[model samples]
Target: MKLDVNALGTFYRMAREGAGLAAGRLTHMTEVETQVGVTKLNFMRGREIRRDFEDATEKVAVRVKLTGAIEGYSMVVFERENALRVVETLLADSDSETDIDVDAGEFDEMTQSAVTEVGHIMNSGFIDGWADVLETVIDVSTPEFVEGVTAEPFFGEVDETPDEDDLALLFQSSIETVGTEIGFSHYLFPKRESMAALLDRLRTSGGIEYDKLDGFDRMAERGAEEVAKTATTLTGIDTSVEIRRLNFVSLEAIPEQVADETLVGVAFEFDGMPSGYLLFLFDEESAHEIVDAMVPMEVDEDGFGEMGTSAIKELGNIMASGFLDGWANVLDTTIDHSTPEFIHDMGAAAVDPVIIQLGENQEFAFVFDTVVMADGREFDCEVYAIPDENDLERALNNLDVDRIEETPTTAEFQELENS
Candidate 1:
């Protein structure tokens, strides 16, 4: 079936509102603000899922099966660090941290109970809102707390169909609670037939219009220019950031673009309008060239070493700040970036952590691709940004809302995939 744009927009709005309710419930339970970021509806094919999760770090997943009407699944997925923070917040009065072993795949009973409650509230908030909006009934199974590294069959595998024709609605939300920001991708992995039914319901329901993404694309282009300017300044060479693409795409589809290639990845979290993640990608040659420029090394190096990585990290910090500064100036909001983390690995492994964390709450990520040129020599690079709904909306609001256009064509996504 061809994707229905109107139905998809309606679904996005419903999911966003539903996730907001879930965040509210969480805030009540933890006495901390549980802000819900924007939500995304991902159309995922089953065959490519393993590759999607292969190197993704494991997290604690609380899954609740759906039995009535919409037959599928709903769950809240959390990274280990956030999971630990949640457990600690839940047992603030008591010293559960001292008694429980904080293994990656294992949690103590008390921690399990707390995380389960979180799952329960999150799942209910999402499904209940969906049910009310669709005017349907959905019975939730008992919330199950399972801890693992990947969403494989052993963890929280919701997709039973493996064929490319089968589509799953992976609705995700960026959740902030207990002084931590984690993602909660609540998946509705209905069978093909069931998905058709849900889409039918959406078609009949009044659709909610979402803001267009073109403005952000333009903003990203400007940010890329700023980054290039920074590189030129630091290196005292003619440097430029050539924007290859600026688009939002499914998290799974992202790695497919740069997969198998060895890359230099630098990432950092930022605190701003809605909080976001910024990543810088570079090929080995590009990384070395940039590092050499940043540090002005005497000996030409073909391989990236510890010192080179540190120099690149510093450059990443500088470039990221320059890019974010443009956003801050345009949006008239303060954007603060954290320290950068550097990694040299295969494309999949390098991006897995950031992609997994951001993907947990939303299936789509805003990828800004750029190729750097230093002294007329081209270098491949990318800067991917995943901002929550709140920030996206705020950023869009700062622009001409009247210019919000229809959703970009599938051809645009295809370009990212094929790029």
Candidate 2:
């Protein structure tokens, strides 16, 4: 259907509003006004439609224009900073400029990439299913009636709905754009070798004590095991798993929170899972320290500013996959996972609880406890199985326990002992 002037304005307004929210800004956008002499064109074998917005502003008197088509849209956002600044301004009333300038050349490249990516998502015909709702909203809000229009779906189909992988790609793209705008090199998956090399350097550089090396090794081993188990379970594989070893770097340069020292946890899920997780655990100080390490000095002079929530969220996302993989394998059934939710400042008293419910009323619970070892003490790790009889039976039924190997009756154990 053709979008009239008012409808087009509404579309722009809605899109810009959403973009403003995504950009973390508050802006007051003037209602989109049609420029004189602008033309609408039909092309691309009845599959594509295009509209242009042009304006000669008094400030620069430049003929700034924006073109939107069926697949995607592009605009020359006055100045490079104005592109981001516009969104920021719309979202937030703050006048703070971005730490790094958006280079015109880079902006063009990234914009083109984003536009193309969004276009492919829209043109996939999956979005057509959502067209009716979109049309309904448009009809209710605007006086202009849409005509000859076939609505598109909502970017993904029932069977081919956008999953975690698609969301991850979009998240990566958004982060890269933000990082590039701030002059930071984006690395979603840091190389394992590089992390290992950094660990080696930290060990030799005397940044960490020689005696603490064993503790670090133990921690790394535990982390690797956790990640490996998770990966195997998720992938339904019985293969051995290997994880990138963890290392302790100097914490002196790290930021402190509430005047307490922080420790950083870094490990990667490798070998078993297709996409691995990067785990970061920190005391308040360590959390700030990592943020300090990541953010440019220009943006955060004291390394005590806001932590990169998006980056941390991505880290959690990766780790969630590994953990889910492990749990699914243990259960021998596939379970869908929602996007990982992040929690910060999780104190010592914080309890991680696992609650399992079966049938109508049977339930069981497990609480995770973290143990700290003394310098001179060696403690063997223990695994305790405390299964609820009813819940266990239910789970056994779900797994079709008949297929799994089972021991003979208690008589067999007594016979073996007697023998």
Candidate 3:
């Protein structure tokens, strides 16, 4: 199937709209003020789902098979405490005389039933949103309850369906509550062919300008994700993208986000169809942490001295290469970046050169505002990926989103042999 950025954008809208609906339902049910929070996609393969659960915190999820508009499974996952808290709400709303303990550390039959209802509400909201957009009906099967520390409950049912490199779209949503606090995420695991067909349908229904902006948003998301992955690999620390944001503002407003104190950073300029400058800034403490993790020596340098600078510069090189390589893969082209320009000055100084160069012809720029942080506040790095607006459009115009697919393994071969 041939897919483009437009389809991906449309699917993003579906995820956003679905999250709003789910939030509204929760607000209505519990009578608490609830709102939708960050929504983004993660593309991962079948056999590897380590990104879904970084550590083995106990998780409780309700899974239900989906058919009609889309096929596969729709799951609502909650932390163990979060699930118990949800049961608290349902029991409060019920006037029955049945005895139930919310904090029992284990689920009873009645408690299980109550949590399943909550999961069903969440699943229905997302399905309704997709049905409205696609103008079709989606039928959901019986709810299945599973509780464990691993992702096996979710994937055990589908070992043969997804190939090794098949891309699965995982959407994580945070519903902000006012008085009571309950945090959970919704996951959709669809068959590859069904997902491809769904994207093709969305592609047939959107426009050009919107597609370009959506394409840029996706580019920023993936670039930030790569930075986190690279940081983890180099530092032996587990890091993830904390906050991902993309905004369009004037050149002057870009510097307003920088700090007043001195910062350690790396800057680079790239040349390609959608070429621009990339700047990564780390706070003094974060820079020190990276040096400690990567260098593993006690360097008594007051400022970013020679040895400290070299360590940071090397990290910057790998980060820049990964960020541009991600963009190149999406656009199916090559983007060459210049030598890393080390920055050991004030925060705003790192962005001034790019601002002066681009401010000449353009009034606004798309700034990828991302925060990549590690556990225990050990690593907190900020990414600023600013690409040329005109060049980005031209490159996206020639982009095919489905070009990123990898060949499937032997799932189909097994099916044929059985037949």
Candidate 4:
């Protein structure tokens, strides 16, 4: 989104006034240099935004390309003084320290006042007007919005767009991809007997409950569906979906970043989809046990195998495809998806923001804990959704498992018959 010019000016003005008040106390430095430096910084910040957002390298030319005329308003005297005090406090400990002996209480009060003033400025009608303009720009840039909403309804009215039917197909495709690529055959809907068995084993060994597993499974299915829908709308891909469960414990002993504790993930996927995979991962230890069980590797391995990265990527690809596909089906459109990316050792850190950005302008989050077990090892799983909790819940409730008939047991049975 483009920065609000008026808002930007207001921020700079407030900052400058604050600097000036603080500069009043400085006897050692030249006022001209400080003021010039502040102005330069403001100009540079604007230029930086333009360069990043608009790719305009001619800094001087871009600076003069104002969207609207600048207002001729003088700085508020009280606000200027407060701004100065704040600037003084910030630069107090700098190597090029100012000679201002600021009163701590007075500085705090003035700074608070200055902040309040800026807040008010942001909430003013001018900012609201700018926000409306920005929202329109964003909607125009996104093709789905343009196609889904008529220009009049899109620009003049905001209404809920009904869900489409293809969304479920996209989700199913993502699930199939993830299941095949990551060896997470248990991740698909209807809770395959093998997956149920795995869950039961984890619960029996780790004392986790069936309800928790059911909840996790439900959430994973829902996440896959929502992701599919989002991907379809955002990227025009109808087969990108992701299933994630967080804060899960691995049931088997394995390698860890620390000595023992870590997180686990389980994912699924589908076919004929863009970015063609759905994936989930667990803590290092949990992954190790899973890998051991899935492949013919010995159980004493210290680290994930060379196939681990590919496995993770395949999983991500499937999930992304599922979500995109689901979204496309719902929107009656198509979307393209990119190859999946995976990062292991993301322990206890803040969730990635890019994932959340997929659902633009919609406030969405996922909050749930699940467990993972393999070969008698246990781990915790936490889940996060792209938009809001309700969306995730709705997607899960609407998931259609019958759309994809291939399950681990059925596949195995087919293999036996073929043999």
Evaluated with lDDT, which candidate comes out highest? 3
Badly placed stretches (over 4 Å) of model 2 are 1-281, 285-307, 346-364, 368-393, 400-419
For all candidates in order, the CA lDDT equals 0.64, 0.25, 0.70, 0.29
**Candidate 4 — worst ten consecutive residues by lDDT sum?**
166-175
TM-scores of the models, in the order given: 0.50, 0.23, 0.62, 0.26
Local lDDT at 275 for model 1: 76
Q: What is the per-residue lDDT of model 1 for residues 129-231, given as tens digits with 9 covering 90 to 100?
A: 7777677788888888776655464333544443443555566456665566665555666655666666676563232122234455455565777787787
Cα deviation in Å at residue 352, candidate 1? 30
Give the alpha carbon lDDT tens digit for every residue of 144-184 in model 3. 88888876666677533455455455565655554564667
**Candidate number that wins on TM-score, 3 or 4:** 3
Q: What TM-score number comes out for model 3?
A: 0.62
Give the per-residue lDDT digits (tens) of candidate 2, residues 1-419. Answer: 11122232232233323333323211112122111111111111111111001112111001111111121211111222333433332222222332323344343433433322322221221112113323421101101111111212211121322222121001011211322321100001112233233234323222322222222223233433454344334323332322222211111111111113232333233222112222334454434433433444545334333345544444435544544444345435443444543445332111112111111232221111121111232211111112232332233334433333231111000000000
Ranking by TM-score: 3, 1, 4, 2
Clashes of 1: 5
Note the clash tally of each candidate.
Answer: 5, 25, 0, 85
Q: What CA root-mean-square deviation does each model show from the true structure?
A: 14.4, 25.5, 9.2, 23.2
